[model samples]
Target: MFLLKTLTILVAIVVIIGAVTLASKKAVHHDGLEIEDLNKRYRMMANAVKQAVMKKEAWKKEAKAEKIRAKGDDRSDTKPIAFVIDFKGDLKASAAASLREEVSTVLEVARPDDKVVVRLENYGGVVHEHGLAASQLSRVRER
Candidate 1:
């Protein structure tokens, strides 16, 4: 669309220049002020057209992303055959709660034959927090 718009603008500018040169029969010289004015106006219009086309493309992409997000909200009873768990956080009580919730959600949606992969990264904090997180990953393996 942008390409077509740009080409159209370019063609319009060419036609405008041709008409201006033909109309100013007595002063069609290159050094004439009217020619310069026509060139400036053409450039300005082309730039404006380009900017508007870019804005339209951006809006289209945003709308497409919104549609995908809306579609993803629908849930089905069938569980996925494979799953992955991403565990990356400091070893704190707050982090532990977040990790626990993520694990529990995965387990709920995961099928019996599904597999979970946890990427553990620990920054020393409460010992119990890390212990609980390790236990969560171990539970995945036990199943």
Candidate 2:
């Protein structure tokens, strides 16, 4: 009976540890903003510029010119977009998975004129890890 009780205790401990381990594991997070959102942000900035110009009485006439410039002559065409991704590599290059997912997401909606910029920081680590990171970046170039 003592042996059975010990085994039951051991199983219970193992189950508790397993549950804690799973709970502690971090989930990967990925997010991106669309170009249209960026354009809206730019428009807001332009409006702010107009507001500043209005405050300066001397620049009142220039305010109209500024507004016309801010509206941009190219309004008839879609502005080219750029997607930026930042990666910090460790010895395991675990960020490669996230990079791949982000790149794939961007590619789905990216136009031929769009750009992808990956800002990477690495102190150099395992060869395979770096290679995997490079491969992930190459996928961006392929698109």
Candidate 3:
């Protein structure tokens, strides 16, 4: 009887911890932005492609990439900066909170000509969660 009681208590404890973990996972994460240089990444990828291909083909690819890279790099006063943000939404849309922060951060530094690019990956999810996620994104235009 004592052993059975102890096992029951342990099971209860485990259940409580599991519930708390799930709740926290679904909660809004306050972690800040993860910034990356798209242009630098592109340059790195271009170099990789150039190295993989034959010399002549690599030159051709590099030439094309160079043109694209130049256009990206030569930012005049009037030219806009592209703020690219990637969001992978789960069923709970827990990432919506972080995305809100990202949009706000971009908006803070945004110029008149600046634009935002959100690469969202959401197959399907709870209706309310999706709606919340969409609202968070719409904040960009509303502001």
Candidate 4:
């Protein structure tokens, strides 16, 4: 019981400090977020790491990657898009409304080959809330 109380106090202090820090550092201008090309980011990071390798091995690795890329790219077709959405949930599942909107938008443009990727971060919650959240996802398949 004493240890629990101490932990609770420490957590409360951390929460207070975190809230203050976030309030002070919050974005003043709410310009929209940029869409990053993850594939490009991976390629750039790989190239940077390759530059640090021993010279002969780096050349060999680069050649192998290039060969695989060339073989994969020898097609004249559109690339399938992966739409990624994040869901941070609570007991009440308040975020489901926003999730519904995101799913609707993705469904509008999503082709059969395109993908809707959801990164769910919900600790187990009330049954009804989970059901609601699940139905929103079902809309994606219903389309």
Candidate 5:
């Protein structure tokens, strides 16, 4: 029993050390979603909502309008853009790096009329880490 307990404790220590080492490493990535793709998704959702609210007979006329809208002809001027970023924060706010990258990308291409929306989920952990995350978000506003 003594030997078994010793081995278990050793294994646990090793696992904890490995986790800490990995957590200390910096890992950041950035990915941008195309405006066209977002528009497609918005149209799909709008279609679903329209289908739910309107009678089937009304669909034909709406569908024609949808086609024109889909063709990108409803506007004579530039349409405003929206940039969306998602961040999931943990005890260390490890996602802050990715958030920084995403914000940088948006700032590079976003116009004055463009908007940035960050969908954030945080466990509300260490003060320093959360502050870092908040600073990352503030970059968007500063731009």
Candidate 6:
């Protein structure tokens, strides 16, 4: 009888302790703006963390790839690398011609070995003017 009574008391104590723990668990609430701000902050933090992880993983993969490539490179010789430039435009006031200075600056940096591939796609303008513009690009190619 004493053991039974003691067991009952112990069970009651355990139940009360469990109830207290459950009751003590806290919940959070916020107003709309506060919730929105919190969500924005969380998104920013999550994005930062994601970017950091991605950078770390990318560096690891790049290092591993470089190591593999270096191993193979020992048996090969470096060849001259080539580049091709693809120019495109439309016959509008906002065409590449408006940026001639900027484009010239880019062309000035090009090595003589570089090849340029111009694609003419102007469909809206003085139709004959596009022909003249394309001819100028051909002049650049000859040079």
Please name the candidate that would achieve the greatest lDDT relative to the true structure.
3
Q: For this target, which candidate reaches the highest TM-score against the unseen true structure?
A: 5
lDDT of 3 at 68: 85
Residue 44, candidate 1: Cα error in Å is 38
**Which runs of model 6 end up more than 4 angstroms from their true locations?**
1-63, 67-88, 91-93
lDDT of 4 by residue, 1-143 (tens): 99999999999999999999898888564433335777778977877687777597777888688779968975454778888888999988877777877787778888888887888999877888788789988887675
Q: Write the per-residue lDDT of candidate 2 for residues 1-143, one digit (tens) a residue.
A: 99999999999999999988887774533355333466668867976777676667645766677668867866543777777777888877777767777777888988888898887887777888778778877877887
* Candidate 5 local lDDT, 11-118, one digit each (tens): 999999998878776444335543446777877898899989999989878998878766886653478877888888898777777777778888998888889898
Q: What is candidate 6's lDDT per residue for 20-70, written digit by digit as tens? A: 887776444332211133444675686567657777887578667756865
Residue 34 lDDT (model 1): 19
lDDT ranking, best first: 3, 5, 4, 2, 1, 6
Q: Candidate 5: minimum summed lDDT over ten consecutive residues — where?
A: 26-35
Clashes of each: 0, 0, 0, 0, 0, 0
- TM-score per prediction, in order, is 0.40, 0.53, 0.59, 0.59, 0.63, 0.35
Candidate 5: how many backbone clashes? 0
lDDT of each: 0.68, 0.76, 0.82, 0.80, 0.81, 0.55
Q: Which regions in candidate 3 have their CA more than 4 angstroms from the true location?
A: 1-30, 54-77
Measured on C-alpha atoms, candidate 6 has an lDDT of 0.55
Candidate 2 deviation (Cα RMSD) = 10.1
Kindly list the per-residue Cα lDDT of model 1 for residues 27-71, writing each as its tens digit.
754431111334446756865676576687775686577568758
Which of the two, 2 or 6, has more lDDT?
2
**Cα deviation of 39, candidate 5, in Å:** 3.6
Could you report the Cα RMSD, in angstroms, for every candidate shown?
26.7, 10.1, 8.6, 9.8, 9.0, 21.6
